[model samples]
Target: MRIYLKGLRIYATIPRIKDANKLAKYYTETNKELGIDVTLDKISAKEFIKTAIVNFNSMKEFHFGIYTKNHKFIGLFSIIQPNYSKRICEIGYWIAKKYREKKYGEDAIKIITDFAFKTLKMKKIFAFVNTNNKASIRLLKSAQFKKTHTSLKSATAFEKTGTHISTYVLHLAIYSDTKV
Candidate 1:
């Protein structure tokens, strides 16, 4: 399936192995900013691609590729840890370094948030943002996600050594009434 936003197209399709090199490069370039705990010392793009395909097929999570209207791959968005019984889920996303601050992240969030609330029938969606990732915090706010009082301390090295994570949430009821 495909979702189109103002300057972006989001695809519910697995990325091809051929796109791995670029993705790996992005991973290498943005490791610090990504806030992932794993060390990609030897990021095997092929392996990553295979895992992505497997994960998509497993139905455990939903991953979408973010692209330009012209089909240029720029980033990824995901609805993770969905609890169907609870009607809640968490969101995750990363834009390539070159695409940072261009509002692609904001657009992608809007698209995914809509998908979660409307299609997945989720009551609420939340995102855990690194406290220091101002760009992402701003992006989430732009997409109408409000910060909750909750916070998490890093169990591992996340957010480039930053120790705290900020939680943000959006409810279906709130999103339904917003004009954005």
Candidate 2:
């Protein structure tokens, strides 16, 4: 899928296996500071790539390579289960360290949301954010996502260091008749 959100200075395009290494490195380098875990290590790159390919090809999910106007690889933005019969989908995105404060995340979300509404004909889109992630919360809010629900003490199998996150769900109505 391809989407252009002019005001955000970014666009979303289909991802490729060639992006795996850079994407992994970007995630590994930024997770410590960002308190997020969304990548596979170098040793797991092959498996990750295969999984990404399957998710893209079989699941009908649009995994976009988030890029800058100058064609720099910023991060990833995607909608999972895009062909859901309920007309609902979830938004997932992350930006590399250097691009965090530049509003690339927000711009990427806007583009993806627009695609979901305009192209996919989705009724609504949702996102689950950790409560501690202020930047993500701000991005969702700026995109007009309203908090619809919350889950306390959500499970985190990856955090052996005892990380417990509160999950907050934000919903965006496709037919709101308002620009995001």
Candidate 3:
């Protein structure tokens, strides 16, 4: 499936093993900013690709590759650790550093949220942004996700990564901010 939004296209097909270098490069580049634990360099693309395949194929996780209208790699969006019975999922995404401030994140969120409900049949989806990550908070807010709660000293991912976090949630059944 390809979702077109704001001139950007999100391709639902997961990258193949031959695209290992591309995945690895992306991981090494965005690992710090996105709080990922992988250190695989370009040479280790195979391992990174392997992990992605395992998570995607076996864990019931969904990942989409972000692309341009012309089909250029821009970023990634992952519906991680879904609970099928609960109809709940968490969205984790990161746009390339160069794509910052381009409104792509907002567009992607809107499209993905729609896909989550209409295609995935999900009831609720959520995102967690570090309090200090003002940009992401603004992005999520602009996407119409309600700021549900803030946790103090809650994050333990990276050095100086903000502990204060705000959880933003979206519910299809209650678009008017009804209590969940």
Highest TM-score scorer = 1
Residue runs of model 3 more than 4 Å from their true location after superposition:
1-12, 16-19, 34-37, 50-59, 149-162, 174-180
Question: At residue 121, what lDDT does model 1 achieve?
Answer: 90
Give candidate 3's error at residue 149 in angstroms. Answer: 4.1
Give RMSD to native, each candidate.
3.5, 4.0, 4.7
Model 1, span 14-104: residue lDDT tens:
5556677676767666665564544333348778767766775675677676777666777778878777898888887788988777777
Give per-model TM-scores.
Answer: 0.81, 0.75, 0.74
lDDT of 3 by residue, 53-169 (tens): 677656577666666565566676777767778887788887778866777777677666766776668887788777788887888778677877533222222434447556788
- List residue ranges in candidate 1 displaced over 4 A: 1-12, 34-43, 149-162
Question: Considering lDDT, which of the candidate structures 2 and 3 is the better prediction for this target?
Answer: 2
Ranking by TM-score: 1, 2, 3
Per-residue CA lDDT of candidate 2, range 1-180, in tens? Answer: 433445358877765466767777876776666555665676576566566667776657767788788877778777776546767777777798777888788778777887778777787676766666788788888877877653222222133244433333434453355653
**Superposed model 2: Cα runs more than 4 Å off:** 1-8, 34-39, 42-54, 57-59, 150-175
Count of backbone clashes for each model? Answer: 0, 0, 0
Error of 1 at 136 (Å): 0.6
lDDT of 1 at 93: 78
Error of 1 at 101 (Å): 2.1
